[model samples]
Target: MNTSASDPVTDAPTKAAPIIEAQGIDKLYESFQALYDIDLQVMDGEFVALVGPSGCGKTSLLKILAGFEQPSRGSLEIQGKSVVGLPPSQRPTRMVFQKLALFPHKTVRDNIAFPLKLAQVSRAEQDARVAEMMDLMHLPSAYATRYPAQLSGGEQQRVALARSMVSRPSVLLLDEPLSALDVKLKKVLQTEIKHLHRTIGTSFVHVTHDLEEAMMLADRICVMRHGRILQNGSPTDIYYRPADAFIAGFIGETNLIPVQMDGAAFDNPALRCADPTLDEAQFSPGHAGTSGLLMIRPELIVMRTEAPDAAEVDCVMEGSVEEFFIKGSSIQYRIAVEGLREPMIVDVQGTATPPATVAQKVWLSFQRRDLYLLGEG
Candidate 1:
């Protein structure tokens, strides 16, 4: 799996210094600890996403970065300077909240120019900067005189992003800014935000619970749970090489078959590995015990009417289709394999010939190269 965070332009390892350095950070609400020893770094011009369920300390960490809430412990530096005690206004980062916090009464131009105005920039400079930002955001000059209530949700989002970028901060923090938009508009703005980031080359630290959104937009994804960072790596690493089963299930639809590994072979009676000489590198590191999970992506498992040849595939299982869902571009099946409590999921392309039906016996096969071993923890 590719673990390195690559630069968006060159697709190579990023050599830029971290624009935001947060080490051993912790946040507490009196006796209740909201965050643990959280250490994160946002590389210059990199986009990182903080993703987890609610109450996972993602928002707390963002608040600490924005200086809205002080950390109970640890150090934070932006551009190599400490910003722990600084106010939000004094910090060099701009945040676009979930609600967008756009001034409803103000015109688009005034809303985008608010940051510049607060910085005491000259009016002429503010106008020029606002105009540049509007052009960059693809907002026409005619819309500049309109209020937020008059503009569409997507347009309001663009205005919020423009306001955040008007000051040209080294890092732009987004707190689920697209959560409220509809699916279609959210996708549109997601593309626009990605393009804007590429165009401006500003570091972005976006916090969201949407895994798909994170995978789509972030260069590196940080998975958090119980106020701690569970995993941090490139999207490929997180998807194909998840650290644990929780992350595996969180990323997408998958099948995690419990297996006992005895040396280089699985001892589970329900599983059959055609290849006896499977490499140990296929297993996750630190899996000391004889137990682990065999992770197979839904799309990787092929449903066959006849048993596949042992030489053709590494693993094979016999199961009957318990249920199925037609997902437009793909067909998802729940296969009931004996000795397993949950049904195994398999996804076939919508274009594939002859979809499987419920109660039909099918052979599920996947190659060793496509299988990933995850620690049972």
Candidate 2:
């Protein structure tokens, strides 16, 4: 893998100082190890999301980096200065909690102006800045006087966002900022947030368990599990080239097929595909007794009622359709292949494509290059 400077998508082009860096971060609660040697860096003006299931330590790591929680071990630096002893309020980073944490007593303008007030900006300057922030967030100036309880959920979200951005913090930590909104509102907010980030260019470290949201918003994603980062990369890299079975399964829908390698070709009882593109003689002699899994995405599998006209690999699999799900953009077919414990999933696009109903026999095939090889669990 050419993971060098030439690969600008994954590799850093220059040694610019990371806006925030956490190294060897270890946190423990009595006997329970919360975080283990966690290492992460956020480039200046980058939008990064920490994503995982519940209790993945994403929130804990964010707190530690924001100076809200002290680490048991390791160091955190901002612009090359160690900030171990700094208090959360003193840190250049600010956090927007899931609750929005707005003061119900204060009006939208007052809430946004609170940060400027603490910073001791002049009264005239504070008013001017508040107006500018409200405009930037697309919040109406008339809504400034309304309290949190008076505004709609979406409006209140804008208020909270305006408050956070008003300070112009070097870094912003968002903890599931859009989780409270309805699906439609969440989507609108997602686009708004993306546009806001582009305009501000401030470093954003967003934490969420929503995979699609993370994929859409993050310049890079940090996938965490059991308090450790399992993988970190752009959405395409993480989705198409998952490092292990856990990552492969977590990122998206996949069909994990057990396989054994004979020379350079993958041999499987279920997979009858042939690849003329790969050199069969150059296969690596994998570790003995170590099983392998072939990861194939649902979309990569082609379903045909009959035979294909193209001279493709005849890796045909005959299975009875167990279920068919009508996803808005695509249809998902679950096939119960004989001798397999799990049903094979295949995604077909377009409404014009013939639907494969339950109990119908179908053939599936795909190219070898599209199949990812990984160590079996």
Candidate 3:
């Protein structure tokens, strides 16, 4: 289910209390406001991703959470205790930066043990903990004596993670830690990070602009825009049931067909629904008697040589293929429908033979239940 006004999405039967909570948080840099009334909660062991375009205040929010920047106006809590002005060192959190900020001159072991040494932990305990972290991060024992420059990018990332995690903080804040890596390494580290979170059971609050990364790594995603959160929910909810047109167009390519809402049905001559009588529930909330967009994902649209069985599908439209793209796993087709201004996108699984050629007349059909109504706003 979609969350309401920044409320945390509760997907489990037994909910865990939040390990980090920010209520009505706002931030300002002199005359420019950077964040709005933001409410967020990270449950124990939950992975939450703050995602948006650059300059959307996600990093500002992350800094606030990490105690690097104080919220201009708001209440901040950690594990049920107020911590608005607490310093980063005093807070029960650690941050892994995008640059993987490992000390160039220090060996891996010394880097991992730095926090413990700062806390005046005994030499024996420091050694034990650093050794344990090295093993946990899958770093070789031999690499402990090597400097940051001696390790590969992925290995250096592991060292940075180990350093942040060695102190056993309650929450781990990641600020685009995987953004600099190549695609293959990013995917490998993504899996490793997910596995590490599951293994350690620590709360992770990751900030990133990559929607695909957020969807893959996070238990819940908060999509932000222009210093405010637009929607926050599970990946499936955000993908299929976006709040508005901007959000529907954010994550991936989608077809948004304009239609006027007439009571319980869409009043568009160009569109056809299998069920003439549509329930009010089929429409988006607060959009009756007004213009709206019908959202259809590219992969959900089916291409047919002949007319589809009207009883089996809810919506059907005839269009001619204007362009086609050969994606490795799927073929993407741009079809020009008479009533729509832009070409409709459809993704079909790759096959030995193409489904339809350019300029070929094709019928696009999709089920009603798969469709979502979205407001233009």
TM-score for all models, in order of appearance = 0.93, 0.91, 0.92
What is the TM-score of candidate 2? 0.91
Model 2: CA > 4 A from native: 1-14, 276-290, 313-315, 350-354
**Residues 138-229 of candidate 2: C-alpha lDDT, one tens digit per residue:** 88899989999998899898888888888889998999999978999999999999998999999999999788999999999999999999
The per-residue C-alpha lDDT of model 2 at residue 335 equals 91
| Model 3 whole-model lDDT (C-alpha atoms) | 0.89
Q: Report per-prediction Cα RMSD to one decimal.
A: 4.6, 4.7, 4.8
For residues 42-62, what per-residue lDDT tens digits would candidate 1 score against the true structure? 989999999988899999999
| Model 3 deviation from the true structure expressed as Cα RMSD, one decimal place | 4.8
Error of 2 at 277 (Å): 8.1
Clashing pairs in 3: none
Using TM-score as the measure, name the better of candidate 2 and candidate 3: 3
Using TM-score, rank the candidates from best to worst. Answer: 1, 3, 2
Ranking by lDDT: 1, 3, 2
- Report the number of clashing residue pairs per model: 0, 0, 0
Q: What is candidate 1's local distance difference test score?
A: 0.90
lDDT of 2: 0.84
lDDT of 3 by residue, 243-332 (tens): 777888987789998887666566567678867445555565635446788888999999997888777677889989999998878999
After TM-score superposition, the amount by which residue 49's alpha carbon in candidate 2 deviates from its true location, in angstroms, is 1.1
| Clash pairs (backbone) in predicted model 2 | none
